[model samples]
Target chain A: MLRYTEDHEWLRAEGEEVVVGITAHAAEQLGDVVFIELPEVGREVTKGEEIVVIESVKAASEITAPLAGTITAVNDAVEADPGSVNSDAAAAWFFRIKPTEPDLTGFMDEAAYQAMIG
Target chain B: MADTPGGLRRTPLHDLHLARGARMVPFAGWEMPVQYPMGVLGEHNHTRAKAGLFDVSHMGQIVLRPAVEWPSGHARPAAHEEVNDLKLRLETLVAADVLGIPQGRQRYGLFTTPEGGVLDDLMIADKGDHLLLVVNAANVEADLAHLRTLEGTDVVLLDARSLMALQGPEAEAVLERLVPGVAAMRFMDVAEFDWDGARLWVSRSGYTGEDGFEISIPDHRAVEFAEALLGDEAVALIGLGARDSLRLEAGMPLYGNDMDAGTTPGSAGLGWSIPKVRRTGGARAGGFPGAERILAELAEGAKATRRGLRPEGRAPIREGVPLYEAETGGEPIGTVRSGGFGPTVGGPIATATLPAHLPEGATVWAELRGKRIPATIVPLPFIKPSYKR
Candidate 1:
């Protein structure tokens, strides 16, 4: 399942952790994702809060966390090659975090993500 | 490309951009198509290898008449040409000779306040009888207001046009076929001609370092002109995305990013723009903002200056990031101005300001999120300038 924000961030869950990245529409709009600053592994982030900064050729964007959690693992590859997000946003997760309070029942699913993008 | 400004603004070719499947975004209060379906990389490469048609109508395109005074004796709104030309003699705008700027030639100029502080930087094209000015979209209203106050001669300001940019290696060939005789115009020259039954002022100039032209046409005819240009096989509609990357590769500075009111021409590495005449004029140099400080800086030399930065790896060091000394990583020496992944350069590049004495190979630090990233000082225009002689 994938949940998206009106601002174009996307969130998904993997077991106890949630994976987050910008949606394809957002990545495309950002042009080239040249640099991405991921949050530290132990940083506590709240839902709908800015935790990452993604810079493109034209401007810098703050990527908001779709859910509250403690960051666990960051995709160093995406930081090393931010263009991966441009090529495949869904697969180029910025980080994986375990929610401080997990309850996936309230989040939007894949259909909602598609509708939000549309 | 479909991002309409809702209540902001829609360029003359707004519909055309959306129709072509452009990914539009709000920029400087206007709905601008930043790129088409071809994406940023494709559009960037296309403009480098071929011709890229850019709908730059969001930029304010104004025409100037010589200045005129009312019966009350108060000067009318300054025509763009008159203010620049008249002020040039007085050195009121900047320490540059506007009148000497050849007809059809494009020159980068700045508006300096009495204190010698920068008001704005713009591209001014002298068109013999009149002047054509292209100002930043965000500052159009303010620029117009400022120009009004400086109109001492017979002149009028007209905002009845939109502009487009056709840039890249094959740009000249495509433009030549569309508008003959443009081929003879040297880089920085301006010429008037017809395109699709409408008259236009074409300048052999653009932000990108390429053989290109910036065409000014009636607002109503912009869509038609855009369509006609796009009809060519070699022309692809590029948006702001590619425009940014292209300029980055060329090492050109964006007004608000690499420069602002606080930064002086000397510190920004724009001393070349200040003519030699102004330098020798000494006491006669017209007073602009921070005149005492800027002129002093010019005479004494800038403390710190803008330079290009190359990060060691693919990770980019962005703006607002601080730079450190090479040997000991002592005090913060400078800050990143414009940093990004330049698709044309195939690497990460940045424009930063640092101590003027810092050697080319000097190392620096860019605070990316909290981690200090290592960066090296390098010469600008990450790629070579390819302007037509």
Candidate 2:
């Protein structure tokens, strides 16, 4: 199951962990992604806390956590090639987080996320 | 975002910009385009390679006329005495030697405050009968107020005029199609011409380090002129985003960002604009505002001087980033005033204020988002200017 946050982050449940990345809408708005600073693995994050910093040629943006969790792993590939986020935002997962709260409340579904962006 | 105080003013080409899919943003009380569909990097590179058209009507254009009436009324021959008197009177407000500029020529000048800080940087064109001054949009009001304080000069704001800049190596060729004799005009030369029954005040000068022309036309004919220029295959409509990056790469300092009212001409590395005629030893010396402090600073170097910085990595370091000594491991010694990813350089570059004692090629570290990135101070401009003599 996939869930979206108002801040344009997406999370997908992968058994015991969840994958996180920014939405295509957010990536398109950010223009070209030149650099990204991802949180280190094992860092404790609360809901709506800033975890990633993405920079384009023009400006910078911060991505917040959608749920309380501990960062399990990060995508080294995206850090190596930040442009991949603009190429395919959905597939370019930023990190894997093990949710502290199993019940992911306050997240929107696919339709809700689409409507929110619109 | 909510509307700012006083609302945003649209330029004469606002409709055309929207039609061309420009991303409009608030800039200095104007709704200006930040970038077009081509994006900042593409637009920047295109201007450097070919020609780029920019709508800079947001800038303030004013004409200063002498209060004195012509002696022979209708048939005046050159009126050299009146022009000379007017130039001398105008020189009281600026640091540049305005009286020395010949007819049909323009020079870069600065309006310095009483404390030696720069109020605004402007271009003054000696138009024989009157002087045409082009100032930054943000400083227009203050500049006008300052100019109004003069006793014998009549300052008239050219609000109905639209200013456009066509810049690049091929700018001359592209502009020659519309104005036949524009190619002959040297850098900083201003001329009045007729284009399709409309009058134009064109100058062979621009903010970009490239050879270009700044065309001032009636507001009603702006869209027509812009469309005609865009009709050329070599000319593309560029936005403020590319303009900023291009000027930064050219080592041009912005008024409010790079050098504000707190920064003096000596510290901003713009002492060249203060000609020798205005110095202490010259004939007409120490007459302009802050002349004493400015001349002193010129002889004895300022505490901080503006320098070009080249960061080591690809991650761009933006403005307000602190600068630290390379090996001292102490507090910040300076701050980045203007910085961005230079599309032409293909990496991050900046202009910062560092100790005047720091020589070129000195190593410094810029603190971006908490990490100290090593950068080297180099001689400006990062790219050589291609102005036609």
Candidate 3:
């Protein structure tokens, strides 16, 4: 099951770790991504803390952490070639974070996310 | 494209831009198109390869001439003596060879403050009987007020006209199809032509560093004229985003971004535009508003100067990014005036203000995300101008 944040981030829970990536709508809005800087693994972050910086041809954007946790791993492929995220935003997970409490009770579901975009 | 953001003004080509699927953004109190479906890089290269149509209606067009009128056409015309009088009077504010500008020629000029800093940069054209000034879009009101203080010249704002640019190697051929004799006009040449029962002011100049023409036509006929040009296979609609990168590659300085209230003509590498006649030893020297330091800086090079910087890595070093002499802990030496990915040069390019006359091969460090990026000073204009001489 996929969970969504109001800031256009998606989280997929796999056992104890949660994978985080930007939504397809966010990617489409970002235009062509030329460079991206991902937060380092082992860095502690709180909810709503900005950790990702994406520079597109048109403008620059920052993605924030949805749930407070420790960054366990980051996707190196997207950082190596930032354009790949635009091709498949859902598949280009930025990082994996182990939530402090493992609670996603506040996150929106798919139905609520769809309505929010509309 | 629907209702613009509150307080944001729309150009005459607003509907036409939306019809072509442009992405609109707020720019200097105006809702302008930043890019179209072709995208910024695509439109940039397209303009270089063929021709690109740009809606520059946001720029201010003002007419400066002696108060006495001698003709019916244009904002106003003057007798030859009045024209010369107007030019000399204009010299009181602008630091350029206003008296030397031949009829039908345009030259880059600047307005300087009493403290020797640049207030704005502009294009001054001597249209035989009157002088036409084209200035930056955001500086319209300020420039008008600056010009309003001048005596003996009627400063009229020709706000009802829509300005457009057709640029590239194929620009001359594309424009020649509709208006003959444009092919004969050399660079910086300005002329008046009658098209569709309206006066079309044509100048063989543009901001893109390509061989091009800037046309001023009536606002109501802007859409039809643009449609007529877009009918050609070579012409495509370009927006502000591409216009920016194009000028960056050309090494042209933007008014507010590159050279602002604190920049002097010499510091901005614009001393070449200040003719010898206006310099220290010339016949008419030290008359303009900021002549004291402008002439002083001309003789003795400015302490701070503008130069190009190329980062070693592919990541773009953006504007307002501070630069330091050392990698880790030192005060910033400069800030990026204009910067972006140069599609033509196939790398990231930036221009910044650095201390004058550095020793050979000095590197400035730009810190981004806790990492120091090394950028070496390179000569301006990542891409040399392709203007038709």
Query: Using DockQ as the measure, which candidate wins?
Result: 2
Q: Which lDDT value does model 1 have at B99?
A: 61
Which segments of model 2 are wrong by more than 4 Å? A102-105, B1-6, B70-78, B326-329
Interface RMSD to the true structure, each candidate: 2.3, 1.5, 1.6
Q: Report the lDDT tens digits of candidate 2 across residue range B1-389.
A: 12335698888898899999999998988999988988777889899999999999999999987776567654333367777888887889899999999999999999998998999999999998889999999999999999999886788998789999999998999999998899999999999988998899999998789999999999989899999899899999999989998999999999987887789899998999988778878888868788889889997878898999999877777889999996447989999989988878877889998999998988999887678889999999988899999
lDDT string for model 2 (A1-118, tens) is 6799888889898887889999999987887787888999999999879889898877988998877889999999999888899889999999999998766556899999989988
Residue pairs with backbone atoms closer than 3 Å in model 3 (clashes): none
Superposed Cα deviation of residue B73, candidate 3 (Å): 17
User: Could you tell which candidate, 1 or 2, scores higher by DockQ?
Assistant: 2
Stronger candidate by TM-score (1 vs 3): 3
Summarize candidate 3's per-residue lDDT along B92-196 as a digit string, tens digits: 889999999999999999998999888889999999888999998789999999999988778999968999999998999999998888999999999988777
- Model 1, B154-178: lDDT tens per residue? 3344456778999988889988888
| Model number with the top TM-score | 2
How does model 3 fare in lDDT?
0.88
By TM-score, rank the candidates, best first: 2, 3, 1
**What is the Å distance of residue A13 in model 1 from its true position?**
7.3
Q: TM-score of candidate 2 restricted to chain B?
A: 0.96
Residue-wise lDDT of candidate 3 within A1-118, one digit each (tens)? 8999999999999889899999988887777677788999999999889999988776778999998999999999998888787889999999999989798878999999999999
